[model samples]
Target: MDKDLERFVEYCKIDTQSNDTSDATPSEAKELNLTKLLYKQLKEMGLEAEIDQYGRLYSKLPGEKGLDVIGLNSHVDTALEVSGKNVKPQLISSYEGGVIKLNDEYSMSPSDFPRLKNYIGSDLIVTSGDTLLGGDDKAGVSIIMEVISYYVSHPEEKHHPIAILFTPDEEIGRGPEHFDAKKFGADYAYTVDGADVDMIEDENFNAAHADIVIEGVSIHPGEAKGKMINALRLCNEFDASLDPDAKPEYTSGREGFNHLMAMNGTAEKASMHYIIRNHDMDLLQKQKDEFVSIKHRLEAKYPKAKINLDIVDDYKNMHEVFLKDPRAVEHADEVFASLGITARHEPIRGGTDGATFSFNGCPTPNLGTGSYNHHGRFEYLSVKDYRKMIEIVKAIVKA
Candidate 1:
């Protein structure tokens, strides 16, 4: 098997799901399993690699001097919504089109995912219906690894100084926590974390989260008539009050939405966790305002109860930074164009570690991993496009 393909399949077998509830760095200890593998592999390849206490793996592959130091980053941890454990990758030799059964329980069709038609003759790697494939960033990781491996083995082929970063908990939005850009030593970077191989992304959602706590007056059923105030009902009412159309299911292409991540409670107290996002900063604030507005309304309706709403800024859109300096994106486009690929610049509906990296000193843009339907059982990787990404990143670092 090819090195990149071999690396991807091997890494997918390990479980590295991030935990949102956990306050610890990396969120879960199991995440280090893959980090340790990367650390060992980097060492074996004679590269200077270090694994930090925060579960971040940083490495450098020395290249031609005086060239801009370029960075490549991808997250190690998978999404929290799906089960990334025991992920069995299903490989298709040549996709002729139609339904590709993952297992007895589930199957993927081009009708459901029109993009599948884009890779008719390409080899593919899919999940076995039981769990997620973890291709969201693993594919990115493999691409970076292969690129580094290529330049390392053939020192005669000159390239720019390369800084590699594999982060944890990107799915939970903590990928950039404790990250030091100056220490990364990269003038610019690219996050290989998107879907399409031909697209380059610099704009991302202005992300913020809202945590709502509802305190209610509980009374016995025997005399509960007018004194009873159920927190569960208030939580449901709070969700129902939000605009029905203003949600992820209904929004697309730079549109903003308030996603209810999780909510649970009883008659005494309940909590609702929501993530609000928009490309425009003003629109993002309006969504936050809506959260505060509903809290006041619910409190007024249930005078005996107290409602606490906390909204915190997570990450801003990286577009602002790119607008000031377009060198990183322009460089990527030029490289892609040289490789006979038209670089499509699009806004990212979701944020990548690049968003935070751009805000920090290093201007960063997001590239793709040729993986689709991320964070779900239906997720799959296109071997042809995946290989193309390796070439694209390789071109970006060429002297």
Candidate 2:
């Protein structure tokens, strides 16, 4: 456990923040820093490891032939919202409660995040406020690595064949762009990238993205009247036409939202990016339809303005795939029972790389990494829970 935590800390220090703007498969060249390290570590374990051209690391451990070939996956990249470089993680033990300060400027409290109270008696790894802790999926990677290390050291222990995948660009939704179901060769898999250790994710939001561009006539302010069509003003009006309550800040659990991700414009031209999400297909369609409705409404309102709205499907709910083949969830239930752990099936508020893998053929459900408040400075990992999840994975593959 100590050695695995050491690996996690070492990984946290490396900057692996993915770039959404970059057209590269891994998104950022720096992402290969961690990928290379993981590749070397996996090789040290005496397993067959290789990195694909897309920057994904695949490794395998031979087990009993009769058992199913299981797969484990996690991403190495950190969120782009905060800096992941030069992360100084703080190790806190014997917590007596109250506020835990990340730094002078930032502190985490139960008042703001009630989940802090759950880790009252456990050890924690937190950020130093200048950057995010990167536990979102790194902890996931650590858990998988620990499981592999265990079987490697104890070759006598019988278990299922394990296929490992460490991906890059997950923070930007490109983690599964290079996924190969045949190459991994697993009957089922799990993406260890969730918050709590006591929950399993079986469903995720059906997602789509809308790119809106508005063109208008730019006239001098002195002659501006009905003749002057400000594209920026139209952008504001277009966003304002959407339902005020149907936004990310206002909704949660089962409720869909239309999130305005980015907006930029001038008097003659403007563009807005929105991500539409919902657990239900019908509701997601409504959200997409609403975008078109607003566009047409605005077009009628402004005859001189030209609005080009493009909506593309990002990913679908993995629940549909799971419905056809539920062995992944069923096996997880058995593993939890064997370990005397009670984990509930919950829908992930966000998507994981598992969603894409599931649609492709592998019904990959998601598990937790014992981390909380991801993609921000206040992010933390419960060391006690982290250790526990390692045990859970070991039991899952036991032969």
Candidate 3:
């Protein structure tokens, strides 16, 4: 196995799934283990490293004066949909454009995903069709590690000062809650969390969450007709109110999505969790307004139903800052084109640690990790693409 992919698989085995329910800054206890492990590795590489009380880990490599410090940030948290613990990564020697069987029950086939053709001659690492491979950001972390190791081994290479930061609870959208941007001390940064080899994202969705609560009167089943109202029925109606075409599965590219995550109800009460997302800020506000109008209409129909709707704004597009300063995006594109990789500019349908960092202070952009079908059994990364990413980093630092 190549050194970077080897290190990535090792890190994946050490689960770091974050908990959103915890009040702690990291939001999970397991996150500390990865932080501590990274601290040791950084110290071994002869860099000053520290893990703050909140489980944020930072490391520094000093360089010549007058050279600006560049930061590389990656979150150590994994998505909560699958088991991150005891992840067994399967390595395919070389892609031959066929299905890869994971167990008796599941397989990843080229017929289902045509992108597999892009990896016809590359090495691939995947999961066992039972658990996730955790490549979402661990691949990012591994890339950072390899770059640091390269610089440490090649002292003659001309480079500026570098900062390494590992954040926690990124999967749960709280990675930047306690991030000290000033303390990070970098003029700009990049989050290696994208899923393609040539993707450089400066735009992300304007996000907001909504929680709908409905109350209904319960009566004996024999006399339930007209005397009792079912909250579950109301909840179903609420779910159907959103445009069917605006769902994750239906939308693609720059199109928006309105996700009705979950609903639980009985005759007495019902509640739903919904998240609204769109790239344009104006459209995002309009989506929220539509939701509010729907709730009001439902309330008017059932006077005593007592429906409550709560909407909370989450994050905004980083393109505002990117437009203000186009140097970073332009420079990255120039370097990527020079390296023979086509730079693809696209809006992120989801959020990233870079979005929060960009809004807070730094104009951070999300770079590619070369992984596909993240947070599932079919997750995989191209070894060739991963190595090309390291070259992209070198080009950025050298420029």
Candidate 4:
């Protein structure tokens, strides 16, 4: 465990933040650095490991009796907010019940996030307030590495065949794009990528991407009084047509949103991208139908103006899949209880790699590692909670 934490800090020091605009598979070459390191370490532990063409790492620990294979997965890429480079982790010996200073201006405060009271006697690992701790999934990766290595080194532990997969570009929602489910050869999997320690999410949002492209005819500026149909203006009209009350910033919990991701165009043409999300299948269909109606309305207003809408379903809620197999929930609950954690089954407001993996036939769910306020400067993790999660995984495997 000590070696794992040391290696995790080293891994976080390398900037592996994925770029949303990049066309490459890994999105950034720096991501491969961790994959290479993990591959070497897995091989050193005398296990089979390799980095695939798409820069994902897959390793296996063969088990006796050929029982249903269990898989543990985590992503290596961090969010693109700040440079993940030169990460310096600070370990707090024990919570003193006051604000812990990271720098002159910044400190992790219980006043802002009252959940800090939950870990009053627990240890913590935080950043220098200048960069993210990268504990989102890096901590998960470290736990998986430590647990798997321990089991491999001590064969006396009775556990099912385990598969470990490290994915890239998960921060950008493309982790499953390059994944081959059939090749993974696992009965089921769990993404050790949740925010809080006892969180186990089997339900997530049904996500889709919408692209609206508007084409308008631009005449001479001098005679533009009657002939100019600005595409940029139409984009705003389209945005205002959606439900204003249902947005990420305004809504929380099960509430969904029509997020306006990007917009770009000249007078002749304009394009806007939106991501629509909802948990209810019926509501998701209604949202798309409304978008189609909006497209027709714009076309009617301007006969010469052309508008096209493209919608693609990303992933669906995994509730049905989990319902089909009761063992997954029962096993996780049993393990969390054994570790003295109150397991909470909640719906993920956002999508996860497990959601895609579930749709792709893995029936995967998300498990937590005790991270909070992710993708921001205030992000911090519970050191004790993090270590407890490793024990939880081991218990789950044995169960």
lDDT of 2 by residue, 182-295 (tens): 999899999999877778899999999999999999989998877989999999999999989989999988899999999998989999999999999999999999999999
Residue-wise C-alpha lDDT for candidate 1, range 289-392, written one tens digit per residue: 88888888888888899898999998899999988988899899899989999889888888778988998989999999999999899999999999999999
Best by TM-score: 2
Q: Which stretches of candidate 3 lie over 4 Å from their true place?
A: 103-105, 217-230, 236-241
Model 4: weakest 10-residue lDDT segment is 1-10
RMSD of each: 2.9, 2.2, 2.5, 2.5
Sliding window of 10 residues with minimal summed lDDT for model 2: 1-10
Candidate 1 runs further than 4 Å off:
214-244, 261-271, 293-307
| Candidates sorted on TM-score, descending | 2, 4, 3, 1
lDDT of 1: 0.91
Q: Considering TM-score, which of the candidate structures 2 and 3 is the better prediction for this target?
A: 2
Sliding window of 10 residues with minimal summed lDDT for model 1 = 344-353
lDDT of each: 0.91, 0.91, 0.84, 0.84
Higher-ranked by lDDT: 1 or 3: 1
Q: lDDT of candidate 3 vs native?
A: 0.84
Candidate 4 has an lDDT of 0.84
Question: Over the stretch 1-399, how does candidate 4's per-residue lDDT look in tens digits?
Answer: 367668667777777888899999899998998889889989999988878899988888888565878889999989878667778788777788789898887887888879888888777778888888888778888889889888988889889888889999999988888777866777888899887777889889998989999998899889998789989989989888888887788977777888998999998899999999998878888888889998889889988898989999988888877878756677788878877888888899888888777777888888987677777667777877777788888887873
- Candidate scoring better on TM-score of 1 and 4: 4
